[model samples]
Target: MLVITVDLVPSGYEPMRRTIATMSISNISELAEVSDYQIEATETSNPLAGTPPRTVRCLIREHARAQSVWALVARASDEIMKADSAEL
Candidate 1:
């Protein structure tokens, strides 16, 4: 079993991370071989941000791989991209 943590940089406009994954996604689907790994997101509020506290989201992913995970993810991303492009 392996764990892949995606840490996102905070945006200037907002103190919290975006809802969608912000990591450079060239190949990141094998960790989710059909969404293989279980995804967990924890949010924390920062009081110093302002009157309306800003909530931050942290994403964590875990998976098991018998072979190279990179290759798996790359293949999956390719398939997804192809399907997505076809919609246009």
Candidate 2:
């Protein structure tokens, strides 16, 4: 069995964290084809500017039964990376 874990650093705003989590959950649900994925808010810290920063953890299974989950994670990561590159 395998596992995929994604860590998110909130953009100095609680709402951003929630937004990202919601997007992630929806993306996982639609692409992963696994119904057992979970996302959790872990901790928060104050940033120098803007709102406080938050951290989130997403857990996804990567077993044979969850092949789609693995594919979804790969796709999501690819999209994120592409966006980051575009920003650079």
Candidate 3:
């Protein structure tokens, strides 16, 4: 899966990253139980003054599933992190 970060100015990428970091399943799980958990944020860009420059917007999609989407995403993240850490 691929996720893109969008920002008006070039420096906005850090803030965007912070937002995603805060939304991590482990962080939210500390508060409430996130179930059915389908949340996807897509960044789309369209040319404004032509193809040279473009404007971007984030498209968020949230849906319900029989199983907890958060579970799957969280597990995947943990597994990936552990594998990477071991390699380090």
Candidate 4:
């Protein structure tokens, strides 16, 4: 299986949730050719600084299936990050 890790920009609470949901849905559709697929979304915080980070991991049985959605997800994710960055 192949694992794709997507690092999401730290936006405020609501936006972060929305971004992950959108990414997960789009990834599932875009990688529908894969026989087996799963997504894990997580958020963690730095103990000292209290900074939070989010990650969305997509796991697929075939590397090709993973590759097919990488570009699309990456682009969309970048757009979200850019928008969030600007708000910072």
Compared with the true structure, what per-residue lDDT tens digits does model 4 show for residues 22-78? 234234445465544444444455457664665554443332444565654454445
Instruction: Please provide TM-scores, in order, for all candidate models, with all chains considered together.
Output: 0.30, 0.27, 0.24, 0.27
Q: Where does model 2 exceed 4 Å of error?
A: 1-23, 27-67, 84-88
Q: Please provide, for model 1 over 9-59, each residue's C-alpha lDDT reduced to its tens digit, 9 standing for 90 to 100.
A: 576555674543221222245544433432222223335643232222222
What Cα-based lDDT does every candidate model obtain? 0.36, 0.41, 0.32, 0.44
For each candidate, C-alpha RMSD in Å?
12.2, 11.0, 13.9, 11.6
Determine the C-alpha RMSD for candidate 4 after optimal superposition of all C-alphas. Answer: 11.6
- Model 1 TM-score on a 0 to 1 scale: 0.30
- Residue 52, model 3: lDDT of 27
Task: State the displacement of the C-alpha of residue 11, model 4, in Å, after optimal TM-score superposition.
Answer: 28
Per residue, candidate 3 scores C-alpha lDDT tens digits across 19-75 of: 212122222222233322222322232346232222222222232224475545555
lDDT of 3 at 32: 34
Cα error, residue 48 of model 2, in Å, equals: 21
How many residue pairs of model 4 clash at the backbone?
0
Candidate 2, residues 1-88, lDDT tens digits: the string is 2334434557667555432222243333444434444443322333454434454445544313345655656654444433312110
Off by over 4 Å in 1: 1-14, 21-66, 84-88
